[model samples]
Target chain A: MNGPYVAVIGAGQATAEQERVAERVGELLAEAGAVLVSGGRGGVMLASCRGAHRRGGLTLGLLPGPDRAEGNPFLTVTVPTGMGELRNGLVARTADGVIAVGGGWGTLSEIGFAMRLGRPLIAVGSWTVEGPAREPSYPTADTAEAAVSWVLRQLG
Target chain B: MNGPYVAVIGAGQATAEQERVAERVGELLAEAGAVLVSGGRGGVMLASCRGAHRRGGLTLGLLPGPDRAEGNPFLTVTVPTGMGELRNGLVARTADGVIAVGGGWGTLSEIGFAMRLGRPLIAVGSWTVEGPAREPSYPTADTAEAAVSWVLRQLG
Candidate 1:
């Protein structure tokens, strides 16, 4: 059986805490037998791919730039989109669900696309998007374990 | 000399006023000898393509789904990305500049990508993004002519 394709979206320049969280999330996802998809660059993305790589999980990185070398070493498969920040949409689209760690404008863009496409999303120490009613649009998790659990459950 | 590649980003289902503005924007861009690009589905996208098509301007549509038939009839060329909403990043990446007519979440995602990529961007009665200092991030034009003029000027 094919594993679920889950994308981990976050900032390339992430905080130490965010990196730790993302790595744990990646490890958990990989252990669950999920195919990991990411933007395929550093910091949060790198950390997540590293975790998954060490666990012998399949990792796919959709690079924003055209050069494959820009992708992190941990990725098992890399596609250099050369589409710049636009590749974020592909990361969101290619995934069955999404887990966001620390994020910035680029990460926000992915979150927006994921929600717009009606994909299941979970955030761990990430940006919060409020709906018209000023309510949080998606569920949030306190830890990486919670996030992975929630996203996997939602996928199921 | 080749004309500039400007993307018209907006909602697939837009307000009538937005559609009118988008059509005029497309007409003005065509008159200026600029190539038009859009998501190429309906509402603002269709109106812009229609205006540009009538003026004999080249229009390219980057479709979200895999089917080319889903694109509007007015598009001169169409690429079905099968990337879903992720194709919004391609639309933003492929253009030299972007003009957003009133938008929804999907349009907002494109705007986010454009700004993140540092692509010259102008909003026409579209979403407003503020920087950390609470200042407007990009220029906004009141009219289609003004939008085309400002984006073209920014490009030059």
Candidate 2:
């Protein structure tokens, strides 16, 4: 994580499995000394940020609103987008690679952005993508550790 | 178009059918006195801008890069975002309604943003969007005329 930037794109209101995955991913990213970026909301975002902050990792949140106060408290930097869900593209652009946990429209959008930008992406669990291309567009992992490892390998 | 603003979100490089749809949507928006907005690159964006410009309608392009020169010549005003594809959210936020003429990662992101913001969206082609609450999220149309009409009707 020291030389690379990896973003964790996941559900804002995560499921139990997604929450666990995001937290572990955050902790791993922090341990690797990589900076973490997210949408700065609840659910997976909150969990990831909390994990990263606990591990003493730097975290940045791209908030949809105009106020930094709207960001999750775990974030070290708050980028006020005032662009709502559109900020997902920024998350993709900012990351050298990305780890997607669970699935949702927002996460899907981030995945699409990452693919379009030619950034590496690792998907955890089902993509929840409708009518996705049959062949895997990116790497898929079953656990947060595997996802983070794949992203790091891609970065390396 | 004079009274309202409509954004046409689609692929940067589109197929023949999509080009026709975008052009007609732009022309129809102009004829209905609604301003045309787009990402302002090529393919659908170019066709729509060309259509609106030919009809003496105002056209605005929200470009992702820093250079206004990268925008299509058809645009009346080229807004240089320097935010890469992140500018798609601005395209969605600026419009009163949006017409999605084709499918791509960029276009899908716009659709998600529009839906989250509760803005009216008319999908002119298949988007492969998942988990969109089947009822009252957005309308789907097969033709440019129908799409523009639906947006205008909603605006009215």
Candidate 3:
């Protein structure tokens, strides 16, 4: 059977804390035998892919630009969409569940799409968006372990 | 030379005012010899496509789902991406300029992508996002004519 596809959404420019969290999240997802998906650029995407790659896990990168070479070296597969920021939607859609690390506008867009598509979502030190009634849409975790565990549980 | 591609973005469920604005935007874009692009479903998308179609303008629908039949019949060409909300990125990328009539989370996502990609963008009765310094990234217009004029001017 195919492994669960879990996307880790974040910004290309991430803080040290976010990068550390993203890497740990990737390693955990890899150990759990889930395929990791990401934007395939730098920062959080690179960190996650590196962790997964070191663990010998399959990693997919949906790159925004036209050059596959631009993807993080750790990606097992790379798809360069040449669609620019639009590829954020693909990164969100191709996953069974989503874990967002520290992010920005792009990550926020992915979060919006993920919520709209009803994908199981978890956030860690990420942007918190409210519904029309001002209720938090998804749960936020404090650690990569919690984020991975929560997202996988939701997938199951 | 090919005509300019202008995307009109908004929610599938729109208010009457938004629909009116979107349709007028479509008419103006078509009259200006521009190609109209959208998510190609209902609400604002259908309204814009309907206006453009009535004006004999070429309308392109980047559908989120797999079925072209789901697209508004006003489209001259329909590309069913089967990418779900990810097609929103394509809608933003394919346009030379973007005009958001009225929106929600989805539109917010598109606005994020458009700004991230540095696409000429405008809003009309739509979401207003603030940047790091609380500055609006794009211009907002009070009417369809003003929005179209501002966006086309930006393109030039």
The CA lDDT at A89 in model 1 is 81
Residue-level lDDT tens digits of model 2 in A1-156 = 355888898777678778888999999999988899899888889888988999999999999898999888899999998877778888898999999887566676687788778889888773534321222357678888898888888888
Per-prediction tally of clashes: 2, 3, 0
Per TM-score, what order, best first? 2, 3, 1
Model 3: per-residue lDDT, tens digit, A123-148? 88876543322324679899999999
TM-score-superior candidate, 1 or 3 = 3
Task: Compare candidates 1 and 2 on TM-score and give the better one.
Answer: 2
What ordering of candidates by DockQ runs from best to worst? 2, 3, 1
Q: Which candidate ranks first by DockQ, i.e. highest?
A: 2
**What is each candidate's DockQ, to 2 decimals?**
0.27, 0.31, 0.29
Please report the TM-score between candidate 3 and the true structure. Answer: 0.80
**Candidate 3 chain B minimal-lDDT segment of 10 residues:** B128-137
Q: How far does residue A21 in candidate 2 sit from its true spot (Å)? A: 2.0
Task: List model 3 lDDT by residue over B1-156, tens digit each.
Answer: 288999999989888988998999999988988999999999999999988888888999999899989999899999999977877878887888999887877877787777767789988877654332233467889999999999889888
| TM-scores for the candidates | 0.79, 0.86, 0.80
TM-score, candidate number 2: 0.86
Residue pairs in candidate 2 whose N, alpha carbon or C atoms collide under 3 angstroms? B1-B33, B1-B34, B2-B33
lDDT of 2 at A19: 84
